[model samples]
Structure formats: C-alpha cells, structure tokens
Target chain A: MKNFYKVGLMLTVSALLAGCGNLTNSSLSSHSNGTKTSKVTTTGTSKSGQYSTLLQGGEYHTSAITGLNSESDSDNASNPKSFEAGLLEISKKEFSPDKYFFQEGKMISASQAQKWLGRKSKNNPEGLNPEDNGSTDADKRNPIYLQQLLEQDFYTQNDKNYDLSGMTIGLSMNDVDYYTKEKYGAKFETKISDEQRLSEGREMANEIVNRLRRRSNLKNITITVGLYKQNVNDSLVGGTFFNYGVSSPGQKKVTNWKNISQQNQVLPVVNDEKPINSNDSEDFSNFKNHIQSYFSNLSGVTAQTHYQDGKLKGMAINITTQFYGVAQIDSFTQFVQDAAGKYLPQQPTIEIKIQTVQDPEAILVKDYNTKQYSSHVFASY
Target chain B: MKNFYKVGLMLTVSALLAGCGNLTNSSLSSHSNGTKTSKVTTTGTSKSGQYSTLLQGGEYHTSAITGLNSESDSDNASNPKSFEAGLLEISKKEFSPDKYFFQEGKMISASQAQKWLGRKSKNNPEGLNPEDNGSTDADKRNPIYLQQLLEQDFYTQNDKNYDLSGMTIGLSMNDVDYYTKEKYGAKFETKISDEQRLSEGREMANEIVNRLRRRSNLKNITITVGLYKQNVNDSLVGGTFFNYGVSSPGQKKVTNWKNISQQNQVLPVVNDEKPINSNDSEDFSNFKNHIQSYFSNLSGVTAQTHYQDGKLKGMAINITTQFYGVAQIDSFTQFVQDAAGKYLPQQPTIEIKIQTVQDPEAILVKDYNTKQYSSHVFASY
Candidate 1:
C-alpha cells in the first residue's frame, strides 16, 4: 500500500509538470509583449467559455514557494514594489486580467533562486551569474552581475483548481554593486556600464528560461522575462524594466528581445540634459509655481516624471506642507486640484501625494483615460 | 580626564531629566484632552516663543529606542496601524503639530515593555497583568489581560536639539484572549467582559504611568495614556480607543480619565444592535445601491462607519469590482464619486477604496471640512 501511494505521488508530480493542453497561436501572442495595447477582439468570453473576471477576487493565493522574505536585507526599498508592479503590468499584455488569476511564484524554490542569484562557482553549477574574480578595486573593476530574482505566476481556473498557464520573471541587475573590502569594513562600489549590464541581463535571462524548460512542471508554460537595472542606492526613483523577451510553450529559450525605453526623472531637471519633452517640464514648472504661489508655508514641492519611449507617461508630484488642520489641508488640496487641471497635460496620468513631516495628509490623482481627478484626505480623529 | 567626562555625562543626563523650565498652567492644557477642538488663543508662537511648525521638515527623526518589531507574531494586522494612528491623533490635541515634532518613543526600552505586558509573577515583579492561575480551561477559568504596548513621543525644538516635551502610550487590551492548552495544542479563547477589560486596562495604565515616572528621562515629560480594546481576531474592522487620561509634568500617575465613545461598525450592519445613527446607514445603503446600479460587474460594495459620541464621523467604503481596464475603472470611480456626493453626509469624512480581484484600481475621498470630493484611479501601463 505504501509503494502504491509513492507511485501515485510520483505520477501526480509528473502530470503537474508535463501536462500541456490546447496550445494555439493566439495563446502564444504574449510573446514580444510590451506596454503597447493592441486590442484583441473576442466573443466577450475567454477560451474557457466564460467571461474573464479581472481578479475574480481581490486576495491573491499566497506563494507556495518559500524564502520570499529571506533576502530582504539586500533589497532596496523601491526595487520590490517597482519590480512586481512592472512585471504584472507587462504580464497583462499576454495573460490579460480578464483571463488569468494572480498568484506569487510557486515553481522556484528558495535554494534554486539563491543559486541563480549567486556568482557562478566551480562547486555550485546552477549559478546564472558569471564567476567572480578576486579584486579589491570596485569603481571600474569587478561588479556583482545580478542583484535579485522575482517570479510571478498567472493561473486559469480549471474544473476544481487553477491551472498554471503563464509565468513572468523579473531579474534585477545592479548599476553600481556595493561590496565591502573586508569583514565589517568600509563599503565600496563598482559601476557597471550600460552595455555590460544589458548584455549580462539578456544572457542570464535566456539561460534561466532554458533551464526551467528542463523541469517537467515548467516545460510547457508561456514564460515572459523582464531585465531591470536597479537605480543607484541613493536614487529617489526606482529602476525600470529596460528590456523584455518571451518564450512560448514548447520553446527552449527566449528570443526577439525588445528594449523598453522607460525612464524616471525628477522634475525641474537641474544640472542634467534637457528633458525628453520640454512641454512636460514647462507644465510641471507651471503647476509647481501655481501651488507654491498659493501656499507660502510649503516645505517643498517636487515631482517624479515617468517617460515611456521619450513621451511623458505619468508624473507623481509630492507636496510637503507645514500646515496641520483639516481646513488648511482641504484648502491646499482644492487649489492643487485646480492647478493640476489647468496646467498638467490631460493625456498622462498624474498623482499628487500631500504629506506633512509626520504623516500623510492627502492624495490626489488623475487617470490617463479620463479628465477628472480623484483625491482622499486622511481623517485626523 | 576620564572622570571629568563621566561627570559631564552625569550632568547632561541630570539636566535632561530634571529640566523643568517655565512650568505654567497654559503648558498643562494638554491634560484632560480629548478629540474636542477647543481653540486656544495663541500669540502666533508656542511657549518657547517659536512659530509652531507642523513637522518643520517632512522626515521624522527615527526612534532612538529599539525592539519595535519584536513580538510581531502576537499582533493583529489592523492593530498596529490603528494603534499608531489613533495615538498620534490623540497626541495632536496636546502636542499640536504646530508645537511638537513627532518621534517614536525614546524613553521606554523593549525589555521594559515586554516585562509590563507579561503576567505578574514573583520572578517578574514589574509585570502589570494579573498572575496566571495555572488553569487549563481558557474560556472561563483563564484569561490573558494585555496584548501589546505602543508609544509615541512629541518634541519641541530647542536651541540645538528637539526637547522631548510630551509622550503618548497606547495599551492594547485583548477582547478575546487566545491561548493554547499545551505546546502546539489546539488554540482556545477567553472572552473578556467589557467591565473586566476596561477595569484591567485602567489599572495597568495607572501602574505603567507610575513605573515610567521613576525613570530619569521619563519623569518630567507630560505623559498621555490611551486604553484600546482590540477587536476579535475574525472581525473585519480594527479596535477603538475606548478611554484616555493624561499626566501633567511631574505627575506620577494618569488621572481624570475620560470615556471615549468611539466605535467602528460595518455598514448595512446585519444581526447586530441598532446603529448609533440611522442616517449613516441610509446614506451608505443609498451610496452602495447607486454605485451597484451603475456597475454590475462589482463583486461586492461594503462600508465601515466610524462613530464618536453617537455621531457619525467617517466611513471607509470598499468597492470590489470585477472590471479591468483604464476606461472601466475610471468610469466606475467617477460614478462612485457622484453617488458619494449625493448620498453620504457632507459633514463626515468619506473614503472609497476601489479595488479589483488583483490590485487596487482607484481611491475616492471626501474630507469632513470640505464639500468637494477627491479621487484617484490607479495607472495601469
């Protein structure tokens, strides 16, 4: 009986890893995916003969994979949020919220992820990073090739359970790798050139995809890969997914890699090259000037602009005020809303975070698709 | 020279603890404080003769005392946020953002807090809770009194540094204490009566205040104490600050306790006692129905209402939608804003969290001090 049970478990594991059914050209269209929305017309129903429910429920099935929070100390505060949001945004192109439910990565184990994130060594073979060369010099010499690996899984509802239909993996590479000279010594950094970073990222992503294809459960699922160059340690904005590629089911590796032209710049670009769009800067300047004029007690007013393909896609403005009362916050929020409508571009999404030195005061936002702005002021009592 | 340095350190600590310059009746106004906003006539400056700056700069000086994240396993998800926000809210009455800068508690160490939270025993003389009876039965025979302790310190600017002027402490008493009969055994709960909970919370607060007064750094600072009753584990909303008291500078114990009639109720309340205000329920129901009529794809539309002294204060509505897309989310958010404006009372602060099965879609809010509503829809790239 015990032998029969062991055999049953093995068969189940094999079926989970090997099963690939109903692969079509349309299902493979997520390949070569970018942020561009190309409308796919359907009969108002998914291939499963049901209307795709965008996140049928709000709670995501927690990751079956462990060790998500293990290497938290090594992560930048911005990397985790930006990496996950960007991946889900990218995945929407192929999996579409209408069709797939979201879940944290389950296929990769902690040991597997740790190995891939480490320097390739003779003793350990699964390392995707290049082998380290012993060097003390950091600025222009030896650099850590990889920083972190994030995985997100997309699922489709089956008869009783959700089937793993697609996966998105994000590889965060370092622009400046920080290392210590000796145990508990001064920290040093090695700057990675753009060319070296992109090339290494692409190479590692391809190798990772090829490797996962060898696993039975990972053999026939659609895989999307994004390569991100993490921002400098002191940078205010997080890094972007600079490049992406996709591997279709039954494929061995990723191909046709596309460069994503996305950049985040602090507004009032000083001591730097001219912004990609002069109009965006001018509008932001006008908006800032208008709010600054209305309120003289403001600590600071600044914005971070997001550009895609050299076009202003969004701007998140931070307005720091010295005021505390509900009356003061409400009045300032009203004026800012009016200023945003008058000065900011209507095509790009705009967000304004109103805050004090102690806590968040209010938040105002405008969606790209609509002219109306939405806002919320926190309650004090 | 080493002895001289030691003497200087002792003098500095003595000065920090015993500095009681300019003690007056006006400075003691923070005593017997509540949510009531009784306007104080200010000469455009604080007692220090400095124009009160509400969090002068946006960044708060982090906590000097450590052990904040310890015992996180014993905390409820909502308790941390509510406790901190509520304490800050209570502190605002006395410390006024205009006068004091916010900081995490500096006087109380982690070990001291842990000691106070444990059951009083001969081995641990500092424990504030009742000594354990060693009974196996949890429901009627055994009970745990306290759950967690949180502290916030407020500071006033000095010549070179911010002087600690006031401090607030939150004692989170459990409503239903969960315990295990044996190691890794089945969990059991002891339902505490309102009389037992409040009486124990008051006693602990008094004991805690007296103990804190003996410390050098904590002795002269004005201390505010709030007693909070944590909600049941399965409840949707967090607990409320049910009572508060204050200790003037140089006082040893909290006195003149005031009952805070604050309660949070889920809207369209079912199988519960009559709501504190019928108008609030009607407004929420109308708002929910109106939005539901406009958006049929919503999974659920519910609200949590906050009341104080039998008067409606705030309502946080969660609109879970099945829709995905910029156009759909924007439209639904617009409709929610319209319905909120038409249905919800103008005096109460209103917040609407628009979400999908996967991620946040948008947010709409109305400040109690203003009629205009603010909304923001999440940008999906």
Candidate 2:
C-alpha cells in the first residue's frame, strides 16, 4: 500500500513538471499499455460523461486531494486489495495565475444578462443564463454560453453603421470566481482593476471596444477606460473598479487590437519584502508624525495625513482664520511648505484649505512629486 | 552540550508556566546556587554598564530574541565561557502588555520640546528630545523622558488662569517604535491594544486624556476621539486617532472627568473567525454580483459597494440620466432598493445618486443599518 501511494505521488509530480501540454491535453488515453488508467484533468466536464474523471469532485478547491480514486470507485469497493487505483489531485488554481479573465469596462447587470438571454431566438424560447436543470454535481459554470450572450447584447446595443463585421465574442466565467475571491461581494465589477493591471486591462478593454465598434453599438461612441484601486483593507472587500468609462459621442472606424492567448504584459509593482519597515518608508512615516506635531504647535490649524507605500502621499491641513491680505496667506503657506520641504527627504504633497471673512474660502495644493503647485482663492462678499 | 540544552529548555518552560511576577521580577538576584546566570530583560537600556548587555545589539526589533552567545570560542579568549553568561532576549513589544499607552493626539513641535526642555530649569538645558550623545548600545528608546517633556510643552501652550495645580503630564516615546515596526518611520502613535489585551485600549486613552486636560491647558478643551480601521491587507495599519479638543470659541471651567485606576469599559468588535469567506459574506458577495447584473439591464446606472464584517454595509448607485420628475427617480431607486431588501439576509444600507438637467445634482442616501434616509437636490439653471 505504501509503495502504491508513492507511485501516485510520482505520477502527480511528473504531470506537474510536464506542465500545460501533456496533463492539460491528455485525458483517458493510455500510456505504454492499453491499460484504462485515469489522469486528474482540469476540465471538469469530460466528454466521456463520467463525473469521477475530475478526481477532486466538481468544486474548484484549494490544495491537493489525497488518496482519491480517479476511476469508478465501484471496482475499488468490491476489491479492497485494489488500493493502487487511487490518484492524487491538484487543483486547477494551483497551476494558474492570480488573474482570471478580462471583465468588461462597463458592468453588465443581472437584468441585462437575463433580458438579452431571454430575447426570443429560434434556438430556444427561455434565454441562455437560466439555471441548470442538471444534477447538483454537474459543472455549473458555463463560460461559453455567457460569452455568446454578452456578445449578442453588445450587438443589440450597437448599430450597423459601426460595423462589427467579423468579431467572435467569448465569455470567461473565471472573473466570477475572481470577483468573489479578490473583491468583497457578489457584485461583478469588471471595470475595477484591483490588481493594478491597468495597461493589460486597457489592452483587454480596447479589444472589446474595438470589436464592438466594428459590430454596431454606438455609431460614434468613444469609450475611455480607467482602473482605480479599491478602498477596503480586506482582499474580499475590494480589489479594483472602473470609474465608468467617459463616452465622447461619435462613431469612428476602429481597428488595430488583437486577442492573444492567456498571456498578459503589464505586471504588479512588486512591493519590497519589508515595505512598511524599509528605511525609505520609515523616514516618510517619521516625517508625517513630525509634520503633524509641528502643525499642532501652530494656532488654528489641523492636519490629517494620507500615506501610501510608507511615503507621505499627501497632507491636508485646515486653517481656521480670516486672512488680512494675500501676503498673509502666502507667508503662512510658504512657511508650512518650507517646513515640509526641509524635513522630508523626498518631495511632499501638501493641500491647504483656508477659511476667512474676506476670502471666505481658498485652497492651495502642492504636489512636490509632480512639481506642480495650484492655488485658488474664492471671491465672495 | 545536548544535555545542557535540554536542561535550558526545561528551565524556560518552568519560567513560562510560572507566569509574570515570578519570571519578570527575578532578574539579577541569584538563583538557587547563585551560579551568576544571565537573564534576558526588556529594558533596551540596561544599567549593567556593558551596554552590550543586550546580545541582540541595538536594533529596535519586534518579538522576542531567541538563542544567544553565538560567537566562536577563538574570538572570546578573554572570557571563553561568556556563553555561560548569556540569555535570550524579548523586546518590549514581545513582552506582555498591560494596556496600550495613550498617544498625545496633538503632536508637539521639535522647537517647543527644545525650548521648554532647554529652559534654564536646572533639570535640562539641551532640551528633552535632543539627539542622543551616549554610545549606540544605550536603550535607543526613552519613553519616560519624552512623556515628561511633553507635559512641560503642553503647559507652555496653554492659558495661565487654569490651575495646573495637581496635574502630572508624561510623554510616552512609545510612538517611535510603533512607527518603525508597524509603519516605516519615527512617528510615534501607540494606541496599540495588543491582541492579548484588546479590552485595555480605551482604558489607557481615558487615563491619558483625563490627566492631560487637568494639566493647565485650556480648562475646557473637549477632545474628540476617533477609532478607525487601518486599511491593510496584512491586517495591521488601522487603529484610532484623536481629533484635537474642540474649544467652542471660549474655555469653560472644567470639572468632573476623572483619572480612573487602569480600568474602563469599551470593547473591540471581535469579528467571527472566518470573516473573509463566511457563508453570509459570500452570499452578500454573490448578491452584489447579481445586483450588478440586474442593474445592467437598466439604462444609465452604476453602483459602488461598501462592506464591513463579512456583510454588506452599503451600496451606492449613480444614475446618469435627466429625470423627467422626482417620481421617475424614486421609482427606479425603489426598484433597486426593493431587490436588495428582498434578497439580503440582513438590512443593507443603500444610497442612490441621480442626475437630471432640471436637478443635475441630487443625492439619495439610505442607511439601512441606522434606518435613516436622506435626499438633496441641487437647483439647476
């Protein structure tokens, strides 16, 4: 029994070392002999119609499933001596990357999916995304059907003048899991780039938009995609979201985007192993504390720090006093700015909001990193 | 050597099992036979004259140091058995915490610390926060001294009418280590209610604040304290902050607030163990996806989600269309709200913002958690 288990491990390792090609493609095919041996495959739904072929059951689980029968368990139950029939199972995610699939820059609502899917078609009356009538153990995630439905919807929202002559839309259910695992809830927000894959995200967005433009959506619609960071501390709560695309009303002939194999170019800014405690970051933190302390000594002023990567991203100070003249405001602003410049080893971002009777409201913003300074004084009586 | 290590292990366990008073109080006093054994101590600055008494050197580290006397014999010819006199050390953070110390919400300027400390008051001439002149091995952190200097500075910043009659102010250099270890710099902010004694944070805050107000500052400065969740995926940054005292234009003759004996009541909301993927959290996550999908069917709309404690906290949706009337916006908002109300197992906060030419900017915010709803419409040209 021990030797047999060791063999299972060896086979799993062999399959792992031989990535992408052999293990991913081969299924139910015999090796040297015509022995009906089973290999744990990533595709849960097998053409052979035997659910046991999945080895780890239907769930997209984490970690390895040990001592699992790859073939039908009926024979193992009848023949207790057949312990060699079991195979080790490694999850698909274990062999994959952090990103799942591309999400649309614009979120698609449940009603839209249902309505588009329910659109009367010759193929069937009830729409595509309907609940499955199959057994609970069946593979429930149907990526292809959803992709087709989305494409059809995009077609419905466009016009022939835009010309989506030759675009085959594909859907990937990968983002469904991506959303729940990386984000906080059930909301599907493809527009969010929580992982900081903006350039790559833009590539995907362009691919979709360019294709849709060819199709017929808005005749002259130009969409600008933006990816913003999520504001939650927990991985499940936030990742990223899109600020909703800005649309310029117009139709233009589009071209020059290509769909590539699951390969992406942009990467995450690999944070230093000890980001918070790194010397540079610590300096920034100390700077913030000292600045806050210094500001406190000054009368009628309060400041809150906004920090990122252990550096002082920005400082917002509120001053409560009526200014006698522009010179006074300038002097005070320069004083604070000079102090920040002197103390910080790096350029600092400072924002000042002032309140006074003559200048009822005013704001001064300085971005040392960008070398840009902006100030506005509201004129009011 | 192995037998000696075994004995050391047993002694260590004995020390641990004995708990605080026995292990903590017994430092230099001779053990059993007075073999002149060494013990690890928390004071980064040891009075043993050999500043190198700390085997780990001078780094302000996190957690306890393990193992000691690692130098090879050839180098320690003068005291070959120096190994016999060494012990493992645990830094202050690693040592047990009775309570998190109160951080002065208002930061003090270096000049102020220098001035009050440099006063010809016989006790200090160079100022309390002067750069260290002693050798590097001395305890790098000096909390007690800083705390005292801070008290003096506060007196300088306040009015003379208030009797600082019985006030004693102390500065905790606690923030220095906190900034370095948790963040990246020397800013001191220690509201750390360590995981072990979370119940004690509020106690410390109150203890520090009550004493501070009585210290001849403004007599009636009411400080507003805010405890915020630090947003970090690693689960550390978030804590609490103090919004400096509100003086309401003039000081009131203050009275009644007391400095209690290290005891108080407020507690942290200890979340359920598996907050990230609780069934309820997942359900909410899925519901979010479903809602986004549903909302997609509607024309001109988008939503943002805010969640806490593995549950939906609030969902804010924005509609981009010119509403013909309030009734139209209400109908659409109600439709989305009703769907959330029906599916969510718990009350969900829902906020909706709509744009129309007549009322280009309008906001409808609903706090289901607090059972409050608000709407404001800005007049248009």
Candidate 3:
C-alpha cells in the first residue's frame, strides 16, 4: 500500500509540473554554481518496548525537557530529567497500534521506510537521531523545514488520496527554562498549531511535487515564503513585508520566531540554494530583465520616470491592490545605487519607471504560484 | 538821585502789592512770618573815588586806566579777596551808569562789568573770609547762586522802569574752569555770545525768585537739579529735568541721572516749612484744599480727579491756552513710592497741562488752585 501511495504522489506531482512554464533558463542565467546546506533534526520514541516493533504501529512521545539530568539530583522534583524520564516511562507503558504515513492511509512502518528516508540509529533503533533532541538558538532555527519534512514523508506514504490544499500553518518558539537561567542563556521552545502544521506540511509537499514535475533541481527549489508574526497585537496571520531578491548576510534571513518580535527588518529568501554572482553580466541582466518583466506583467499600472538636470534619475512603481489599493515605489534610484554601485554597469545614469499593478500576481508571480503563499491582505484605513 | 530812584522803586513795589490781595490772614496764613535775607557788601574804588560816587547811583565805572591798574593790582585774579571786593571790581568794570539806566546818549563797556564778574582767576586772596567769599566750600559752590546775584543787580539797575512779566529765562553753568582743567586746562577759551549771556542773566534771576519763594528752614533745601540746555531745534523751554533735594555729606546722591533726564514726574510743594505728614488726614486735606485754591485762581481751565481702589489717587489739571488751546495734564500721581523705596512727601506729580500759553498766568493760577486745594482732582494721564 505504501509503495502504491508513493507512486500516486509522484504522478500527481508530475501532472502539476507539466502545466508550469519553463523557468530553468532564467534561473540558470541568474544564479552561480555555489551551494550551501543546512541540516535540521528531530527525535522521539514510540510506545512499544521493541524499537522495530514500536515503529510498525504505535503512538510516540518526546521528552520536552533539556539539560536537567547532568546535575546532582537533590530533591529530584526540581530536575526536569526525572520528570521527562517518568513521562517517557508512562508513555512507553501505553501501547496502541499506529503507522507513520507519507500520504493518506499509506500506513508505512519505520522498518519499511528506513531505507528510503535515512538509516536508523543502532543505539536507539526507532531511526530517530538522538542528537536531534531539542530546540537551541530559538531565533535562528527555521520551523518551515520541519513542516516540509513531515509533508514529504506523508506524501511518500500516501499518494493520490491526500489533498494538500486548504491547510494553514502556525509556528512558534519560546524558552521553557528562561526564568530558571541565572545569566543570558535562552532555553527556548516552539509550538506549532495542529491545523497550521498540517497545512504547512501539505503546502511543502505540493511544492516538492511541483519541483519534481518541472524536472528542476530539488536542491534549487524553494517553497513559499511563509507569513511571519508581526508583533504580539497583530491580528492578521501572514503578509509580505519585504522582498528577498536583494541578498546580504544579515540582510535577509528567516527564523522560527517572527521578525516583528525581533524588531528586525528581515527578508526571508525564497531560493536559498541560488548563489549570488558579483561578476556575471548575465546576473545583472537577469536582474534588469526580471524588473522589466515585473513591470510588464502588471496591468492598469502606470510607470513614471523621474529626471534631474535633464538626466533620467529614478522610477516610481504605483500599485492598486485589493487591500492596499494604492501603493507606490517612491523611487528606485537609491535602490539601484545600493545594488549596482560597485558594478558600474555601462556607467549610464540609471532611471526607474514605476508600473502600477491591479493584479499583483502578474508582477509578483512567486507569491501566487507558491502553495505556501497565503497572505493576510490588509485594508487601507 | 539814587535815593530818589530807590524811593520810587519802593513805591512801585507797594503799588504792585496793593493790586494783589491784602497781606491779611488769608494770604499771611500761606507764608512764613520770619524774613530770609541774603546780604551782600560793596568794596574797591566804588568805596572811595568818582567810582564810589557812582556806586551811590548803584553803578560804577573805571575813571581812568590808573584806577583800572590799582583795581587790577588789587584783584588776586586767581583768588578773589572778598564778595565785596569781587562785587566792586566786577560791577565797576561790567556795570556802568549808562548800562544801568539804559541811557539814550551813553554806552557801557564790557571791561567794567568783567571786573565785577571777576576774571578767570586761581590766586587766593588775602583776608578772604570763608563765609563771605564763599571760598571754603568754594569747590562745591553753585555758580547758579552767583549768577542769580548778578542777574538781580542787573534787573535792579537796568529794568527798573519795566514790568518783569512774560519774561523768558535761560540758565547755563558749564563749570568752564573745572572742565578746562580736566580736558584742556587754561588753553580753553570760551567765547560767550551776547544772547547766551543775556539768557544766563535771566535764568539767574528766575532761580533767585524760585529759591526765595521756597524758603524752608531746612538747610537740605539746597537742590542740585540738572538743567538741560535745549537744542536750538527744540521748540519748548523752561522744563525741569530732575532734582535731588538734598544729601548728607559724603553720601551719593543724584545716582539716577537718566531718571532726571526723563523728567516724567514732578512734585511741587506750596510750603517747605512744614514736614510732609503723609499719614495725617488733615495734611492731605490741606493739600487738597491748596490744590483747589490753585485751580480756582486759574481761568478757562478744568480740574478732574482719578481714584484707585476707592482711594483718592491723583488729579488731572486741564487748561485752555493760546498755543495749545486744550491741553490736559497727561499724568499726575501723588505719594508714589520711587525706585529707592524712600517715602518722600511733597513729591509733586505734575504734567504740563498746556504746551504753550497765550494767557499763561491765568492757566498757572487755575493749575495751582486745582492741584493744591481739590482732593477730588485725581491724576491726569
């Protein structure tokens, strides 16, 4: 059944990719060869005493507590290690038959999926790595990766029966032992709402299917930039605050926590695998072409160019969306200067022309095309 | 002839007094009983020769240059011997028989008058009594007094037949010697104009009259009031700047020259003999009475009063004169506490009710009556 589901999911992904236009040339032209990777891991234990048997069909539990066992266990009530150990023992006693599945009703046990996913650990043979135990560096870790991995695993188990649409995503992080710390250390924890986590898993699966259908490099593929929590009082879930095409180390990076809480201007890169090329004319051209294409795609939009001293200076992009119906890109001269100051491409006076967009989807294609691209469109007051 | 003239002068004075109200209780009540006399003596050739004979006629002249020589020899030139010698010498040279009588066929010389007026001298005279010569406090001596004495002699001699009404007075005291010693010494020579000299004479006479009128037993009656020489461009004369009534020795008085220069307030008293009893109800009542009397004496003028906080504050004296037909005392406030917090009485609050007068005497009488007698007349602004 699991093998049947895997085949179905691949076929579905193939269908989706067939409908998408070829973007390989544009992507290839813009990006360099350099690639970087980030690894994230998680660990848990099943209810059964036998590791292989527990993987087949059972409920699982993970110890939430961290770093409490190594110290002397005087009045063990204060130690989280004792509590976690106790909870683990209780969970281990409760045995129920269950299966981990990639797609709906695909019932794949840990023993069956071990080869395709990754090798199981010899010490703790449920295949979950012991090192992938808990959250650390709460602000830097990405929640989307975990959600995507879950979706991918589910799709591998269940193929055609699962629907990834109509799902939402919720991500959060905090330090459980924050008050216990005497110094600046942050003992962080994160919780994703069940509904939101499911939604994110489905969206990520859909993205992967799309990438596979298009025959694009899986390494180069990017999921939708998720909605970031603005601040404590913000009612809306997701909104695009910044674009991520412009890159720098501290410039655009996403984490488990929201940018708003950090009081930081962060732009989460949609395509992190793509390398930035400083010397390539194709890269500059691609940037220019992308900008031009963005302007052309927008309908009912007006482009206006600014000039100073008889020289073309900058452009303003005015957009009329449903919520922020009238929005403007004040001027592009400064941005161009910041982006292209060192390159000195043609040494020509760069001017920008704004193109207003009623349907922003045409200009910001990535936002509409991605499955995880749900946004809370706000109404202008 | 001198006796005959003297007798005639006495008769004329008597006639003038008769025209005025009798020295009955009404008038006598306002004046002091005791006489205040400023006695002077005569000396030089005027005591012995033809010049002496001329002195009987109340005039003197140099018979010959030899008499001039003896007189000049006797003249210390630096320090005048006595008031008598000074007067004799000055009168002989500066005043002649013709000068006194305004004789149709004769002319008087300036040299004769110069001797009596005394040359610019520094030589201290022998047997010069400090009191008589005015040489002890000579440095502090007021030139205004000497000038007044000279004017009195001039009026006594020359204007014996003329009424001294509607006469203008001008007074100037530059302390030429002191000024020269400080700035240019004996090198400075002042060329006195006839008009200037004449004006000085008139002012001297007016000062004498004013001083005589204000005869209080208090030696502190001596006031050094700054007299401003009006520019030729100015249209008005006979205005008081500021006056410091009296001072204890070695004390700083006249500290505020600017306040005096901007003479916006005036305090005129009727009788300096009595102490200013500001706290006494009768004293204020008497003051009001005097003001009313003064106002009544004036003709074609009106008086008004102002009240503040239900208290009789000030009086306004309005006059209708020829030049400025309807002029009102712009401001008049009594019992004002000056900047130094000194509670001075008889601090006259006077504003010239009229700019110029066709019938000044009438206006003057009206103002005097209103100011002194009427309690109802408040300050004019």
Whose lDDT is greatest here? 1
Poorly placed runs, candidate 2 (over 4 Å): A1-381, B1-238, B241-273, B276-283, B295-335, B343-363, B367-381
Score residue B345 of candidate 1 by CA lDDT: 83
Query: After superposition, which runs of candidate 3 have C-alpha atoms over 4 Å from their true positions?
Result: A1-381, B1-111, B118-351, B356-381
What is the C-alpha lDDT profile of model 3 across A120-192, one tens digit per residue? 3454353211223234444433322221011112111232232211111111111121211225554333334
DockQ scores of all models, one per candidate: 0.02, 0.01, 0.00
Name the better of 1 and 2 by DockQ: 1
Worst 10-residue lDDT window, candidate 2 chain B: B1-10
Candidate 1 is scored at a TM of 0.50
lDDT of all predictions, in order shown?
Answer: 0.63, 0.28, 0.22
Superposed by TM-score, candidate 1 places the C-alpha of residue B322 at a distance from the truth, in angstroms, of 25
What fraction of the true Cα-Cα contacts (under 8 Å, chains A to B) does candidate 1 also have? 0.00
Please list all clashing residue pairs in model 1, or write none if there are none: A17-A216, A17-A217, A57-B357, A357-B58, A374-B374, A374-B375, A374-B376, A375-B374, A375-B375
lDDT of 3 at B250: 29
Give the winner by DockQ: 1
Winner on TM-score between 2 and 3 is 2
Q: Over the stretch B1-381, how does candidate 3's per-residue lDDT look in tens digits?
A: 111112112111111011121222111111112322111111111111112111212222122211122111122211111112223322333335333321110111234323333423354221111123343232553222111111112212222232111111112222122213234334332233334433453343334334333323212222222222211111111112121122222222322222222211112223342322234234344444433332232233332322222333333334443221110111111111010012111323322232223212111111211323111111000
RMSD of 1: 17.0
- Candidate 2, residues A226-297, lDDT tens digits: the string is 322222221111122222232233423223332221110011113332342244344445544533442332
